[model samples]
Target: KLPPDDRLAVLLGVIFCIPGSRRAAMDDSEEDDRGPDESPKRPLKGQACRHTASKSSNDDEREDGANDGQERPSGSEGSPSKKKSRDNIPEPLSSLHGLVPESPPRFVSLEQIMTTANGVTNMMLAHEIAMDDTFKLTKQEHPEKSLEHTVKKILHQAFWQVLEDQLAENPPNYDQAMQLLQEAKETLLGLLLPHNTSLRAEIMEGLDVALVRQQAEHGTLDFGYYARLLISLMARMCAPVRDASVRDLLKIEGVVPLFRGIMDQLEVMKLDMVNFTIQEARPLIQSHSVAYAREKFRAYLETQALLSPGLDPLVHTRAWLRRSHEELRALSAQYSPDPVLNGRGASGPPFAVVLAKAYIQLLCWDPSWEYPETLSMDRERFTLLGAQVEECALVASVLLVTHSVGGASLQDISDFKEDLRSHTRLLLQGCGKCSEEELTEKLKCAASQAIKEVQESLQKHGFAPLQLSQERMLYDQVVSMASAEHHIRKLLTMRILDFIKLTLSSASVGPTKIPAGLSTLEKELTQIAGTFLRLVTHNRAVFGEVYTDIMAQLRAT
Candidate 1:
């Protein structure tokens, strides 16, 4: 509207006075603050054009700035006459800030992205349709293509792309990548559902690889995530077509092998983390989907059973009388070594003692209550006396081992015994309620029968003749092991008393049915009774009073 010079001066002043001018000024100040030894800052003289361009030539100045690849300067510089002359020029014009140079447009076009994404999607869809058709043909008659192979290929492609993309980007666009992966997974799952009979094994294999990658990347395995993913995938694949043949194909055996393979790989790759992961996953593995858990547990049990003998070596021996003396010396060394005796050493750990007791219990159970097929032993009649004996031995072993380690107390043993007795009584009462008279009569008859069987078995097994000698020797060992402490003697007395009470109670109730490959309760009890009797005989001077008291109690009963 005004004269050309005035209009140009106004335009120049506006361009130079923009917010970008402050930014450019601050940048210049920062550069000056860095000191002169760093990169020398060339003063931006071309920026003066922002305050000097003619109104008609403002667009031309912006084009020049873009072409020259130089930033526009802020503020006036030099004498007032020079500033006035520069201010008369028109300001530069730009789509962005007028003070900064514009960058040249890059060559990559958005059309390329849209076209690539569309082409890939279309190709994936076509492949899925082709796979479905092939699966249908294979089911009908032509077996040229397998559904498992097709699904495997699709999953391999999808997972490989995801892994590649993740590795290429430094902090990848993870949300978008995850979405794409999820879509790929869903599509593959859809294809697999209709052809589940043929695809389950391959699908499980693919899942195994994915899980392995996840574990390897994270260092710790997450059972819940893997479990839920598997469950969802299985549900999807099995929901659409419910065929018996297809269901059989989806059976746990086929799927479990793949998961087992994954676990094996994890063990091999990250052995240190495996134990921690297993411990954490224990509850998850046991509670969620119990059928699958049971199968896995059975497999683990079978493996453990195969390895048990090599790990514990004491299970295969019998001839107690012949080996009893030799084992005593070894037991002494194991319990209180020469170094420990000389050095005032503490006892072994409580857990070690627990482990030892568990071993002894296994021996007492084997070939006594539940005869193994390998042993070819005849089954004995049920006797509450035998059950009592097994229970007493287990309790005594736990007490002796725990007490020997200097960890557990006599009070703990007594408390545990009371709990056990209460539980046993509750179990018996739950089995059926009878009148007091009927229960007493049954108890008397069972006790008499048990005594007769014990006498016959002792005679047959030659235990009666060997009992005195074994008891004497074991008693001496117990005294030496206990250092003649009143507490030890008291603990031993409690063990005997508890055994007798449990025996009488068991006799009153009748023998409990044990699992196969375990000894009858009566036989185990007789063995423990003999063992205890030996202890008393060998330590008569120290334990004689308690032994007499126990004998009187047995007689009275």
Candidate 2:
């Protein structure tokens, strides 16, 4: 080593080791898609996903290539498919074909295949884990003290006893303890920043392994001094969350125990740093995530293209866009004779319209067909989101219908509202795949309960209960709300759709406050909506060209 400033010449002295440094590195690819419902009081988790578009000529915030979090995949590379005219916009020579094969791909190495597979798997898993509403890296103390815990303690005690015996020998063998100390020094340095010059110097000088080795050779090495010094420095540097553990290190008397405490505290601090880094990176990640994910996916797509042409990476993508094109046509026909949709005016919906419709399909996706490769990472998320929407919609509709029928009679029934909401929501637990008939049955049950609760409330309050005819009319109306054709159900669904539609369009960025009338359903629905919009927004930016081509073809026809 060069000098004491060099920091690692303590060859034959004690050092510490911790497993915390082995944690998998986390990238800034998350869009804050926090989703969970263990506690209804807690809002859905994660930040709104954002992606900018070329159509907006966004001169505002640009992360990677996104502007204002609106989505436009082509950016400066290309333009969106315009409303009426197709000028300055190029057209695809042939339709996107995922079912037909053109040519077999050349041989690809196993290494290449494994590399791409790992990257894709890691990206998907990381997002899924971090998306939990209460996800945080934690180290539980004592952890119920199971048999395994006892066994681990015994093994650790035996090892420390052997180490104690070794140190007590005439000339102590510092081999293992030295290794541990070296490991600790490396870990502490890992926690430092370039600007932390004074702390770095303090750590390097205070724990100088060279000087420690010299002292050990002369029978004068003070293990407690090193441990206490490390504890002192850590107390100054650690996050407040770890302050208690650092202080507890001072209570230990034996060298082995003190060193053990030091390593344990170091691990906690290491994990603490990780969690802090993730929290700090959230905003930056949100801003650049759309573009960042696109670049990663682009690289993966190219690799797949070269490896296996027969296995088109975008097969589901083509199918997804095709469905949107069909939807756009149906929508246009449904509102025909309108100048804008007929191409006689400039008010027609752009690719954003088609894109919104496509995302809506995810709410009730056919489970048999694999989700689009572009959205494969979010299949589980979209499934849960579908349930949240249906749940919110059902809850709101039930309450609205209940109040209408129970009017005045159940006016003072404060507890009835909460009761109805809880009962209706309970009927929908794990209802991701409920059939149309099953849903109607659930709604019928909800209707009966509403009436029962209303009668009980009215009788308890000494008010006249509803007449039989009134109950019959109320029951029929509530059950009918189960059908998609019903006005209230359809209206609520449309409002939910509008919320998502506006959220996806560049014209409606920062739509945290939605339109009125969805007050009861806004909390949970908004969370899912923000995540869905962001995922779709980033996805659209990545596949904007494919969508633009499909839109152009549909418009031309």
Candidate 3:
């Protein structure tokens, strides 16, 4: 018999070999079982058992040739080639050279045979139980709570149970059982080595004790379940390591194909979400615009008729803002898909909802708090009020233009604005005196005059002719799409110019202190401005005159 130390070394090598050591034995067993006509079974995924069998045959043929002193093919008659050939032979096979006897041992130990038989029986039982249909059904029903998952969870319990049983047994089947577990541990450690050597070693020790204990208790090794558990643990352990590796690799390289696929998917998801919100919000947006315009005009009419503007203007605006908030919130909730599903958050609400919320907050602010009666028309008061108004208009215009919701073209917006402007002439027509068509013409004339005056003002201020023309064209396009009251539109344009003037003025420089409530809206506006700046820079080639003017204007601010 081989000495205990040499035998242990052989066992260690066997454990280390895993599939390589077991494959030849398994193939031999299958050959013995096969009928004359039976074809070979295909190897499982990532397995090269058949190749190993072919390689073993080649090795045997070489050994036979060497025994007969036949000359073999050689790349070179060199020390390096001889050394490489010797190195290529597996350590386990080489270690057996002096250890294996010329003839098989004559005596068989009854105790050793019984222990091995019992271990084999235990292994068979565990494999059979693990392969039961109920386990498969349970796995299918609750994948996260499957036998495989449960095994991982109860790993410590199973390990201790096996360890205690192994220690308690009169004659434990530690050799066979521990070999099975060592094979699993070695396989897992191979994949997780270098990164988590200490962790893997601890797990291996626990696994070794558990396998021995379980085999001692049940008379069969739980190799199937334990193998699966080790595989799962390897995957779980490797996931973060894989991600860190990917990030490091990415830093050194161009775009990875896998990441490109992920980006493509993300882009598709973003587009789908944006399109969905636009489709849902279009009708609501149109109704909101119409309602706002109607309320503003009605309030204006009341103000004109009353001795004092009274509380009606503020009350009506507050009521409209509240109603708009509710409707927009409902629209957003209906259209905005769950962000977590896409592994993202903090995207905020849809564009329409954001604008509506900003509008409501701006309009619902108590003017008296900042502007008492004495200071109502002061420059500071007008600046703050005008800035808020301009912000609302700007946000609303951005929402409209970005999505082109409701298919509202510039012409359609112009027509809609023209219709709203008729209200001004209607008030002048005195007690419903004018026709809709006649009022429309008068409203059109007034709007044209207002636009012409603004253009002239730009020219007077030394705006380049080409730049001014382009600016006017873009303004017309944007203003035509605006759904606010005509007075609001005019005042908004003026406030923008005022803001530009303030920004350029030597009175104050850098950003001004903003209130907390206005911070969100202000941040959004800054982002929008940055986006516009980029567009102006990149598209200068196509819209050079317009972009040049816009750039000049933005830079001035």
lDDT by residue for model 1 (362-464), tens: 2234334433211111112112223443344333332243233322232244544344333333323311123445434433433333233333444554444
lDDT of 2 by residue, 1-557 (tens): 22321111110000101122222323222122212321111111110111223313332322323332233344444335443345644555343665544342255544454445544543443343334434445543344578856875776677677778888887788866776676677668777867999999988898888888888888898888888788888898899878887998899888888887887777778777656655654454444445445555776887788756669777777788778767676577687856556663333456777677788888767768668877787787788877777667667777787788778666456687668777877865554357778877887887888889888888888878999998998789878766767788767766776676666664735555564546755666778787887667666766677667666665665
Q: What are the Cα lDDT values of the candidates?
A: 0.35, 0.64, 0.38
> Worst lDDT window (10 residues) for model 2?
9-18
Per-residue alpha-carbon lDDT of candidate 3 for residues 375-439, written as tens digits (9 for 90 to 100): 12122323444444444444333323322322223223443434433432232232112344543
To one decimal, what is the Cα RMSD in angstroms of model 1 from the true structure? 33.7
lDDT of predicted model 3: 0.38
Off by over 4 Å in 1: 1-484, 487-557
Q: After superposition, how far is residue 147 of candidate 3 from its true place, in Å?
A: 34
From the highest lDDT down, the ranking of the candidates is 2, 3, 1
TM-score per model over all chains: 0.17, 0.63, 0.17
Count: clashes, candidate 1: 21
| C-alpha lDDT (0 to 100) for residue 11 of candidate 2 | 9
Best TM-score among the predictions, by candidate number: 2
- TM-score of candidate 3 versus the correct structure, residues matched by position: 0.17
lDDT winner between candidates 1 and 3 = 3
